[model samples]
Target: MQKKILLSYIVIILLAVGISATTFWNTGYNYIEDENNEHYIRQAELIANAFELTRFDSANDFSSFTKSYADKYNTRITVIDLDGEVLSDSEVEEQLENHGDREEVLDALRGEKASVTRYSETLGTDYFYYAIPVASESFTGVLRIATPFHEISNFNNSVKYSIIRAIIVCVIIAFLAAF
Candidate 1:
């Protein structure tokens, strides 16, 4: 009888830990995604609204202007003309093919803002993209910003791991105390 009771207690503790870990991971991941998405959207809007090819006195300065933002935010920014041609890109050196077909670009071209979270084939990592159509007279284009998903994902995972470890330690302590 004592053997069965002890076994049952162990199983219950294990089950509790399993449930807690799963819940912690899911909630943490979702929260990270949401918070970062909002950040990207706000940044895209700010950039698109303030963007101008001549902001630096000439079109030649566009790269430097964008490079600063990209470096500061740790994001990739690409300026796309109405025809989908990439005018300036923070990541790619060579001109990229027409982006009019991309979902986010298409949405911006259609005169509406759009965003998506997906895996980037070029970067080989997941990212959250937010795009907005430029309204400045200096340029009529779309500003697209991509925020890497890995950092948030990895941080959340580390949080989950730490929480799971803590729970295991607590369970062990409680079990020992019961004896």
Candidate 2:
């Protein structure tokens, strides 16, 4: 009877640990994703405002500007015209293929802000993208910023590990109490 009770307690504690770990991971990842996505959207918006204030219309000038801003934000920035043609890019030295086929660019062309996480074939890793439409009296376009998913993934892992450690400590204490 004592053995049975101990086994049952162990099982219950294991189940609790597993459930709590899963919940912590999922919740942490989603929360981080949402927070960073919105923050990047606002970053794009602020850059768009800066573009509006500037008189630099040359593609080279725009590229340099975006490169500097991308460095400041620690993310890649790409400016695309309404037709999805890449006008400027912080990461790409050469011109990129038309972005019209991209979902975020398409959504922005349709006047909606878009955020997404997807694996980039070119980068060989997952990335989070946020696109914001830029409009001014003289020019209009889309500004996109991308950051690697690993940044947020690392944060999620840290949070989950912290919770898992707490759960382990609690389980140990409870098992001792069971005696």
Q: Which parts of model 1 have CA positions greater than 4 angstroms off?
A: 52-58
Error of 2 at 10 (Å): 3.3
Question: Candidate 2, residues 28-103: lDDT per residue as tens digits?
Answer: 7788777877787788788778877777657777888899899988888888989899888887787788989888
Q: How well does each candidate superpose onto the true structure, as a TM-score? A: 0.85, 0.85
What's the lDDT for residue 152 in model 1? 62
Consecutive 10-residue window with the lowest summed lDDT within model 2: 51-60
Per-residue lDDT of 18 in model 1: 79
Clashing pairs in 1: none
Backbone clashes in each candidate structure, one number apiece?
Answer: 0, 0
Model 2 scores what on Cα lDDT?
Answer: 0.83
